[model samples]
Target: MKPTQRLISTLAVVATLGVGLTACGPEDDPYGDGAGSGSGGSSASAQPSKKPAPSDKATDRADGPGDCGTPPKLPAGHKMVEPAVPPSKGSLSAKDAKPVCTPNDWIYHGQGKAKYYLFAQDVKAELSTGPGRTKSVPVGQLWVHAGDCMTNPGAVKAPYTCSGNIYDITLDSEGQINSIKEIWHP
Candidate 1:
């Protein structure tokens, strides 16, 4: 093969690898067994995680705020929407009358087996919201325009890092994460 051809081929391979690796940042902890905060991390996995105990305090408030009695009034006429509580796939269950909001530091296990896994801050954390910069623009509310899913966390840019950020996850009937909203706290 010509030298130019070989050089171009090498560049193409490097570019491809760069993109794949950049998706999940090297510094980003991406693997965990549904337990402690930022315990372990790696790339997205295909298998299900071993169920943890049902008494995890971090995941105690599996449902979102105002779940039991009054639901929080979502701005832009967005009300808390989700399916009725279904039997949990793992230790987490959506046991509520309204939508299922799992409040914990769940790592978003990337899409797999046609299901999105939200383990205890250890699967692969995928924010329905796209990327954004960090700046105190408004209150806890995430400023999202119409036809937009959501913006990245105020402090952190990447969503898969999943370490200290707390989130309210909406699970479907089959116990799969549908949408995720990161809660800002002081």
Candidate 2:
């Protein structure tokens, strides 16, 4: 490949873009994309993204603000960046939304820690891609329960186990994920 072309490809793979929050603040269509008929311009149920997990440093809760406690700690050699959004007519604000407190700083997957930040109650699962919701996966000593991915409603931990590592997540205005979809891959 030409030097210029290679540079472009490298740059392209690094670029991650997201839709911005609407100024409607829960009063209109999401990002005004006309994807649903919920509201002309409402806060819209959370948002989506292609970016590597949106970030806020994980921290120990103290007398003052430190971190939300859910954003995963940066494993060595991993880069975590904020989500980017294009200019929009308006945007919603998650400034008032209280982040759910998590018991652990990192979500342990099979044998290692997961790189994604999980806000269990705030994200939606998109199953059209052939990935189903998990009842809850055992992470470290805590059970990672997601009500959106539950088969048996109200169950804290389902017998099912999460197997895949590929996923697509959307981020909210505060850099927390709002939606997740499992991507099947080989």
Top lDDT model: 1
- Among these predictions, the greatest TM-score belongs to 2
My TM-score estimates for the predictions, one after another, are 0.19, 0.22
* lDDT for predicted candidate 2 compared with the true structure: 0.30
User: Mind giving the per-residue lDDT tens digits that candidate 1 earns over 67-102?
Assistant: 111112333422122212221333322222132222
lDDT of each: 0.32, 0.30
The true-versus-predicted C-alpha distance at residue 105 of model 2, in Å, is 34
Which digits, one per residue and each the tens of the lDDT, describe model 2 over residues 1-186? 699999998776666322243343322433423232121111111121211122322232331232222323332332222112211112211111122222211221222233335444444543222223332222211212222222322443334322223334556666555554432221
Q: Number of clashes in model 2?
A: 19
Model 2, position 143, has a per-residue lDDT of 19
